[model samples]
Target: MNKAWEGDQHNLKPLVQLLHFGYHQAMSCIFPVAIFGTLALSSVIQIPFLYRYDAILLILLAVQYLMYRSGLETRDEIKVICIFHVIGLVLEMYKVWMGSWSYPEPGYTKLFGVPLYSGFMYASVASFMCQIWRRLRMDMTGWPGFVSSVLLGGAIYINFFTHHFIPDFRWWLTALVFIVFRKTWIIYRVRITTYRMPLTLAFIIVGFFIWTAENIATFFNGWKYPDQHDSWQLVSFSKISSWFLLVIISVIIVAQLKYVKANRR
Candidate 1:
């Protein structure tokens, strides 16, 4: 043992070590107790009925905003995230209106388990992402936030059978989107450093893991499409191709969004 290392380790006291379990219980409570409370209430009332999922999401977002409020959280951060909420809300609402998928109605709008609020679900996600970026020292500074989201968003959009997000295949063209979008993003948002190559590769690999998780959820939930009208069950080459198709689809969505955003601006 080096003298300096030994001295530093010895300097730690028993009381100081007790801080290790600080916030785990608090966060764990969020999933079961808090979320469950809101969801149950949301689902039970009809005159003010709303999807439990939507209500729980709104609660979480409000909570997240409170958590991430810096002594001086900037207006710009708030603006960017609000835009995310608006865009997501519009996209989902449009899908609903188009009969892409219907949610519990002939013509009912549900928000926060009541009515007239569609954006809160996404506002909550944006706030959580904001908090994560702050902690990771990640740069969500520019188009990276917007561009990265399309791929991630599409993957989330596809697995309606699980989690807060409901999946839709209407925009399957996004499969070829992210690869080219990665190049575009690399050019515009990312400032090149020596570690750029590895960091970019890391992002791609992480995306693959996310895709794998999505595949399992969607596949098990009977949330998949048949190839030539034949269901191959799961765990076959067809399923593997479906995952590959997601990568391609993500790339496409990224590119399409990049184009639209660029041309619009």
Candidate 2:
């Protein structure tokens, strides 16, 4: 038991703590939730003149500005999210061209057959990570050195594109990820007690939730897998591995940024 709960009187401390954890988790998800809501609402509602994709892009821009003005996200965090937006958009364009998945809707805010708002799906993941890192006061221990981590991240990203032409090296890279991060741990606080989890486990957990969200996103017609073109179906469970790897890249970028920011202080 955590020392923070030692003073429990009614034996409800465990339940209370669980609720508190859930509350903070929800708070950390504001951006993704907003994106999901927009996807769901736009699916059924017909805008007078604007295309659904363009409307979603406009709404998300407003949401981003409001989040900044309301102090829900800091300027640095927003910059990180924007960096992820570009990274995700580029991947999206390439993947779509390769016929991995597609945006079936017509929109003025499209480039290379991809809707501009599609990038926000990736940005929302970074938004969740940044929000949770701050909310829980997260810290890392046993992280790999900067150069090594960057090289691994770069390899993981390039493999995503090159794997189409060459033999897939994802499994080999996954092995390297575990080797590199074997000793890493992430410490976070809930109430007055601190807890630590293996960094790789944390990546798996976030990856699973993102996979769940991917199913919902597909249900709402956010994008379509080739198999889902005729009718909606659950995203392949195998994609969890992909999300797991992508989560690693996201964490590495955010972690490096946080490291640099802290050192400058």
Candidate 3:
């Protein structure tokens, strides 16, 4: 440890430690924070001619660029974000088609009733996971066989769509996840101290937070679930299960990248 931080760790007050941890946690969420801030602003403001959604799209793109150019995001992370963007866009297109959700605002940047910037919402989730993983030096142990895990993730993704037409196997998938990741542990650091939690628990915790953000997003009219079409309401807690599965998908992608990069070194 550095001389300054050496005794500092032992003597630090709990409130100070909490504040420090909070700052670091906030740093890991910069992308999500930026996008959410923009959403809050756009909800209340209007431009003369340009659509608010279009302007927000441009702002999000610029933010992505600046994050990269400023060395806050890496080339590999950008690739992951782009992948997430496309995945999100595709899902949004389908969900809007199915009346699962709808974007009510007018925008020139919309495709098939989905605004281009809408994808950034999902990308923001990826950005959060990627940044947090790196910032905390997160690692996993007792991971299930990668091939099986990836296959399970794919099934979970597929079920998201297929459930509308056929039987919903999400609960079963959740069970499988519990089994596969039963022994897996996510290890991360806070300052010089290390902590660990079950990977499945981490997924559930992230899912709950994302569910909270969803409520905020809906309140700002980012998009609306069917229940919100009449009036804004708290998003259903049931949706947390869906977000949990989605987090699994995101984690699988990030973990694969980390694993491959590690092997190359």
**For each candidate, what is the lDDT?**
0.41, 0.94, 0.90
Stretches > 4 Å off in candidate 3: 1-17
Please write out the lDDT profile of model 3 over residues 125-186, one tens digit for every residue: 89988888888889999988679889998999899889999999999999999998999999
TM-score for each prediction? 0.41, 0.96, 0.93
lDDT of 2 by residue, 117-136 (tens): 99999999999999999999
Pairwise lDDT winner, candidates 2 and 3: 2
* Candidate with the larger lDDT of 1 and 2: 2
Top candidate by lDDT: 2
Clashes of 3: 0
Q: 149 in model 3: Cα distance from truth in Å?
A: 1.3
**Residue 84 C-alpha lDDT in model 1:** 57
Model 1 TM-score, all chains together:
0.41
Measured on C-alpha atoms, candidate 1 has an lDDT of 0.41
